[model samples]
Target: MRALVLDRPGSFRVAEVPDPVPEADQIVVQVECCGICGTDLHILAGEFPPTPYPITPGHEFAGIVAARGADVRPDLPVGARVAVDPSLYCGYCRRCRAGRDNLCENWAAIGDTVNGAFAEFVAVPAVNAYRLPDQFDGQLGAMVEPLACAVHGIRRLGLLGPVSAEPTVVIGAGTMGLLMLQLLLHAGAGPVAVVDRVRYRLEVARKLGAAQAVTDASALGDVRFAVAVDATGVPEAVETAIGLLDRGGRMLVFGVTPAEAAIRVSPFRVYNDEITITGSMAILRSFGEAVDLLSGGAVDPRPLLSEPLPLEGYGDAVDRIRAGQGIKWHIRPI
Candidate 1:
């Protein structure tokens, strides 16, 4: 099988590697599409500590089942199309036991900690692969992972239970931000405003149903929101999102910021106004809901996708992502 192998930070190649064979209770998937994420760039730069070198780097993906281990259930037979949840947790850890598996003490993921779907074939645990509906194509199936993350973020915002029309401000109109915007609208969150420096992304946000889309938060001056979400992974942007919150506002840090990154929030304001600030990690039990949302036509991420690249185009795709050329990029290894 041909895969984009990252031998170390700052270096990678499309190399020929032996095909993956499913271990016990695992299934081998013929990868159809794999989306590059910010975490992928971090892994490439040696910034994400959990990543190991000489590994295949891709997690957001979907594919057809090519083989299954002997113990796998009949429901997950070969040829089934599916989207995989890359999260790998030590089930016995305290965090996992507490139902916070995303924060597992021995946390790992498919692409982050093991060889992943940036190849013609990859082996994953059968339990992590959620079967997709017949209507789901490769690109849309690949989107389920990010949408799952957004779903978890929404759950963290406490908006899942009821139609809490909290005036919401989503910072950064990138793929994740746009997904957040759509979910906010779907959850009946009201008058959702989107902020991004890129006017192009703001346009996309508007088309996707943002009540207000601006290149900068200053454009919405004096308009405080009840919910503030930072999806840019930029500390400055996080602070800007914080500034847009109303009294008693809830702020969700949905972005992946650096470990050393820090933000300034008024402690006095948090105390006086009873502000709630929460951080969302990766996918939790949200993957199934995301799959349902996508398969059922409730969320459309197709607008965020451009033409996918072949396995060999992985480097160029990375450059495009770094250059901010597109909303999302995918790799079709098949």
Candidate 2:
């Protein structure tokens, strides 16, 4: 099989690799589509180390079952469409037993820790694959993971109030920000505002549902929001969102910053205003909920997709992402 291997930091190469074989309780999937996530870029740049050298990079993917291990249930026969739940955890762990698998102490991401779906075929534990509706295309199904994450974050904000018309602000206009914007408007937010440093992304945000989009933070002068969210994946953006919240307002930290990054805020103001600053990690148990949203057409994320390339184009794909060229990129393994 031809796979994109991260040979080392600052490099990726298309090379021949042996096809994966499923364990007794696992299944082999013929990967159809894979989404390039921000974590993949960080891994390639030597920022965060999840695995040793020479690993395939992909996690957000969907495909058909090509083969199954001997112990796998025969009821789930070959050719079943499925989406991969890339987070593998020990069910006996304290966090997993407490229903917080996303926060498990010994968590291993599929693409980072293990060889993931960046090739024609990849093996995964049967317990980690969720069977999807037959009509669900792999391209659209690949979005379930990220959409599920957005669902977890948006629901955490408790956006619904008796009024259903509170002013909400979303900082950042990337794929995550746009999805959050759509979810906010769907939940009946009032005059949602989107902020970003890039002009094109802000425009996409407006088309998705933002009432206002601005590249300048000064444009938000004196604006108070009932709910605020930071999706820039930057500590500075989180701080900005904290300052934009109204008294008793709720702020959701939906972004992930570097491990070394830190933001300092006033403890005095936090105590005085009754402000709620919450942090959201990966989707807790929202994968199915996200698939339901996309399946039902309540939120349309199709427009957020801008680029599609084959596995061999992984390097160019990352370049485009680094250059701030588009919202999201998809890789077709077929």
Candidate 3:
């Protein structure tokens, strides 16, 4: 099997490696499509501390089941198409016990902490594999992972209650931001306002149902939203989103900001306005829901899909993502 081996930060090569053999409770998946994300870039630059060297980094992916361990569920037979949830949680951790597994004390993810699906074949826990509907291809299946993250973010925003029809503001019209915008609309959110520095992305946002798409929040002067979501992971964008919230509003920090980044927030305003601030880490129990949403066409992944490249072109894919050339770039590893 051939895999992208990151021998260390700033170095990687497409080399032949032994095919992964499933553990007692794991299954081997023949990789089909794997989406490149910001986290991959972090791992490449040695910015993500959890990542270990000499590993394959691709968490958002889907493929066909090639083999199964003896202890794996009998229901998941070989040849089944599945989308994997890469979260690797310690079931006994305090946070895991409390149903907040995303924040497990021993937090780890398949791609981040261990070898992942950026290869011809990868082994994953059988439990993390969810069967995709017959209608979903590898591209759509690969989208489930990121969509799951966005789903969890919306849940953190308290979407269970009645969502006010007031305009919701989504900062950053990138793939995640656009996905969040669509989910909000599907959940009955009133006219959404999307902000992005890229004019083309704003246009795509409008096509995705954003009532208004602007380069900056100031373009919609004095406009306040019941919910504001920051998907840019930039401190300045987060602050701007918070400032756009209305009284008694909620803010969801769904982006991965720098560990050293800090934003200025008025404590007095937070107290007086009854502002609620929360953050969503990664996928929780939302992977299945994301699959359903995608299958049902509630959220379209086509608009976000960019041209796929072969596994050997991984470096080019990274460059494309870093340059912000497209909504989502995928690697066809098969």
**Once model 2 is optimally superposed onto the true structure by TM-score, how far is the C-alpha of residue 28 displaced, in angstroms?**
1.2
Task: Find the 10 residues in a row with the least total lDDT in model 2.
Answer: 155-164
Candidate 3 ranges beyond 4 A from true positions: 160-162
For residues 165-271, could you state the per-residue lDDT of candidate 3 as single tens digits? 87799999888999998899989897899999999999899899999999878899888898999999999999998999999989999999999999999999899
Which is the winner by TM-score between candidate 2 and candidate 3? 3
How well is each residue in 162-212 modelled by candidate 2, as lDDT tens digits?
347888999988878888888788778867999999998887887787888
- Candidate ranking (lDDT, best to worst): 1, 3, 2
What are the runs in model 2 whose C-alpha is more than 4 Å off? 159-163
Residue pairs of candidate 2 with colliding backbone atoms? none
lDDT of each model, Cα atoms only? 0.93, 0.84, 0.92
Between candidates 1 and 2, the lDDT winner: 1
Index of the highest-lDDT prediction: 1
| TM-score of structure candidate 1 | 0.99
List of clashing residue pairs for candidate 1:
none
lDDT of 3 at 287: 94
